[model samples]
Target: MDSEVAREQALDAAEKLFYGRGVQAVGMDAVRTASGLSLKRLYQLFPAKEELVVAYLERRDLRWRGRIAEHVERHDDPQERIPAVFDWLEEWFGEADFRGCAWINSYGELGATSERVVAQVRAHKRAFRDYLAGLVTDAGLADVLAGQLFLLAEGAMVTAGITGSAEPAAEAREAARSLSRAN
Candidate 1:
């Protein structure tokens, strides 16, 4: 296959194995086998597992972040904004392959060992926080409250991941609605 196709294939395999199985458990050979690509080809594309991991995080982020930005723009009411996030979560977590947030699960599976993956995860977390900050700013919300809501949403995601259930998302929505009304 061409370099582009090989890279994408590698990324696909890496993302599933790395996220579902954990970065440490899924070796480069496994990714190669999963992608039906040779070891040399995989190395040509990624150079290192770190590079492949960075690609995996980028791929996941691009998919979710774009959708999130679209959802955020779909409504003008700031009150409607926070709930859009939970709505997206409910829909995604309801998927048959739902294994909770891939990012958080990967973090748990890797702990703080993989600097590259950890950095990628932190960047994604910042993106989420900034996304929430944007919504709060748009709505003229207090900075402190905005920070609280951001953390609350994050805590909810972590909870859902821990329990393999989305009840926390519903709880988050109810809490968000109440907060919205207060605003």
Candidate 2:
């Protein structure tokens, strides 16, 4: 297989295994098997499991944020766009393979042991918050409201992940509505 194709396959397998299971639980051999890449090729693509995990996270971050952006941008109203984010989350939480936030899961498992993992997690979170900040600004809401919404969304993700229900997204959306009004 072409190196880029092999790399994408490896990352796809890594995202599935790492997100569904945990970073530490899934081994590189499993990734190789899933990707149908030879061990040598897998190692050639990802020198270490950490490299694979980071690559998986980086790719996931783009896709995840892109999905949210697509959903939110569907709204013509900037104010409506804010709540649309929760709508996206609710849909995502309802997925059969719904696992918690990949970044959060990775951070919980490997943050202390791996600086690179920690960096990926932090960068993902910061980007998420910044995205919220942009939405809040565009909606003419106070800057502080962005932080409040960010916390609400983050809390909702954790709750939905743990309870395996989409209820938290609805709950968070209501709270966000109330908060937006207050602002």
Candidate 3:
């Protein structure tokens, strides 16, 4: 396979392994086996597992945010759009391989020891918060409202991940609605 296809195959395997099993739990050999790539090829593409982890996180962040943006854009009203984020979360939580926020999970697993992982997770979260901030601004709400919404959404992700239920999304949406009105 060419570099692009090889890279994608490697990332696909890495995402499944890293997100399904904690990042530290799986080794490059597992990714190599899963991707059907030789050790030489895997090392050539990734150089290091840390590099592969960064790539995995970057790809996942892009896809996750893109999906949420698509879901939110289905509504024209800002009020409706904000809640649509939770609606998206609810759907995501119900997925067969859902394992909470990948960034959060990666951070919990390796943030302290791995600078690349830490930076990737922080960037992902900052971007998410910024997305909510834009929504809050569009809704004509105070700037602080975005932070509150971010907290609610993150809390829901954690809760849903732990409890293996999507109910937290709805619960967070309700709390977010109350925050919207109070602001």
The lDDT for every candidate, in the order shown, is 0.80, 0.94, 0.94
Question: Model 3 TM-score?
Answer: 0.98
Model 3 poorest ten-residue lDDT run: 104-113
Residue pairs in candidate 3 whose N, alpha carbon or C atoms collide under 3 angstroms: none
Candidate 2 per-residue lDDT, tens place, 1-183, comes to 789999999998888888898989999889989999999999999999999988999999999999999999999999998899999999999999999899999999998999999999999999999999999999999999999999999999999999999999999999999999998
> Candidate 2 has what TM-score?
0.99
How far is 71's C-alpha from truth in model 2 (Å)?
Answer: 0.4
lDDT by residue (tens digit), candidate 3, 55-159: 999999999999999999999999888889999999999999899989999999887899999999999999999999999999998999999999999999999
* Every model's TM-score: 0.91, 0.99, 0.98
Worst ten in a row by lDDT for model 2? 12-21
lDDT at 117 for candidate 3?
A: 91
Candidate achieving higher TM-score, 1 or 3 = 3
What's the CA RMSD of model 3 in angstroms? Answer: 0.7
For model 1, the run of ten residues with the poorest summed lDDT: 91-100
